[model samples]
Target: MTRHHSPTARLAARMGSGLALGALALGLASQATAAEDYRPQPDQTPIQSSKNESFFGKTMDYIENNSYGRLGVLRFQYYGSSSNLHVDNATGLAAQAFGPGGSDLPHTGSSAGNTTTLGAMIGLYLPKTNHHLAMEVQLAPPLKLDFQVSGDAVDQSLAPTALNGANGGSIPTGVPPLGKNLGTFKALPPNFTIVYRPWTHTLVQPYVGVGAMYLYTYDKDVNNKVLNAYGEPSLYLSKPVACVGQLGSDFNLPNNMFLNLDVKYVGCADVKSRVSNIKVNSPTLSPTFGPVDVGSVSSTNHFRAVLYQISFGMHF
Candidate 1:
């Protein structure tokens, strides 16, 4: 409708059209242009993994940084062991009195038997590795190593002395063979072992070790047969040295405590002991078997045993 209209009305209409076009242009510009992704400084590194919060790890870190210490804790162990006697080189007719008599215990002559005992252990860990140096001692009632023997001397009625110029003596009593408590086998000091672990953080901890042992014999009471024939009856044993090998695993517990199950195989040399004096009841044997004599009374015994050690320990 081309109707006559005022100049003011025309001006108003043009202004309204211009304002609407301006608004549309502004909205399109906003849609077309946007800021690029923000960039960080080269020194900054982005997180790649989740955070960890282990109580044990945090405690270890705190102790390592704040304190200076290397001393380790003391561990106590209760154990049971079974041992055997392997006689290697037994010489001298004199040894018949001590060895052939058989043993007092059922397993005596065939093998010495078992022991149940307590032990104390101390150790220090190497700087950063899993290696440690430790020493231990076993305290149990002495294990008797009893062997069998004829309990009496040759009958005095068979008076060989009468043949000689000497007066005949009364016959010695005749009694059956009996087992005598010769000595006690014990594992003593200078016990040293090296222990090592493969990993620090593990569900189950595994370890290995090797070491040596020094053994001692006590209460070496001679058999009754020897006491009747000889003036003095005593025994001697050479200290045995053994090589040890061990394998074990530890179970983790709370509060820095652990329980371990361990097994050890000890390889030992023959137990060769020299019975120093066997002065014979006969005058001629007196000269033959003197203190300074060899091949008189000496024996050899080999030994190997397994020890199961279960230990309860804690770290400081």
Candidate 2:
């Protein structure tokens, strides 16, 4: 009366139900995968260019530059003047007025130097900014620092007759024509400049700049004839710090090479210098003629000058 089903029938029915459920889950998973893979007919219009592609194209079209290295020649003209006579210590014949001792008495003198030498510069081109802007360091080595001095009249004793104040426009009274070569010295003048190239798109590029420069002298062995007439001679000069203004241009050549022309005006400093070590032998100039004063022999050199330079260079 209970209508009991067989155990085999029950087992087959359960297995069939399990198979249908598994097939349904697999079908759902397949549909989800197809949905993910299907892209709805991507917008019919074309996509806008990306920043990267635009940048790449511009790089090829515009004037693109990288690190710049150059070799140049500098033609320099230094114009300046000197100031008074002074010495340290004591015992040498005073320069005319003071007792056998150094004096600060200002004397007048003018000097100038000129040379043409090799120079070089290396720098990196700033990125993502004005293509024309670059920071550069320039190195110029002067093979010859040829200095010459001339001033007011002097007696046979070589004393400046016209003192700095008494002379005309720094010219002294009875000042003799004292023109002599003070010998050549080596110098290293380094400049730090911000170069501005106005037109880089063209084959020829023009640039202007301002810089801070330093003039340093080395191995300056001077045999001053005037100083030697009195005794032994030696010389010293102040390395000056200056401001420079420059103008230049670069012409492009084959194979990523360039020819450059540059001009600069360097304004130098005004300072006092010393000339030392001499035996004062003239009795007329000093009573203590035979004795030499190591400390008392020196000269004051007040100098302010502008250095003009013309340069040529090659760059890659």
Per-model TM-score on C-alpha atoms:
0.48, 0.60
lDDT (10s digit) by residue, model 2, range 1-316: 1122455864585477457534543332233221212111112222232345444333322212234567766666666655544446454233332444444444444355676667777544443334476656676544566655454312222443311343343222232233456555565666767778887668888888887776666556655554454554555667777777878787777655677777777775664445556543333323423432334344434444343333434332
lDDT of 1 at 158: 12
Q: Pick the candidate with the highest lDDT.
A: 2
lDDT (Cα) of model 2: 0.51
The 10 consecutive residues of candidate 2 with the worst lDDT sum are 34-43
Residue lDDT tens for model 1, 144-190: 44422211212221112211224544322222332433333333333
Clashes of each: 9, 13
Task: Write down the lDDT of every candidate, Cα atoms only.
Answer: 0.41, 0.51
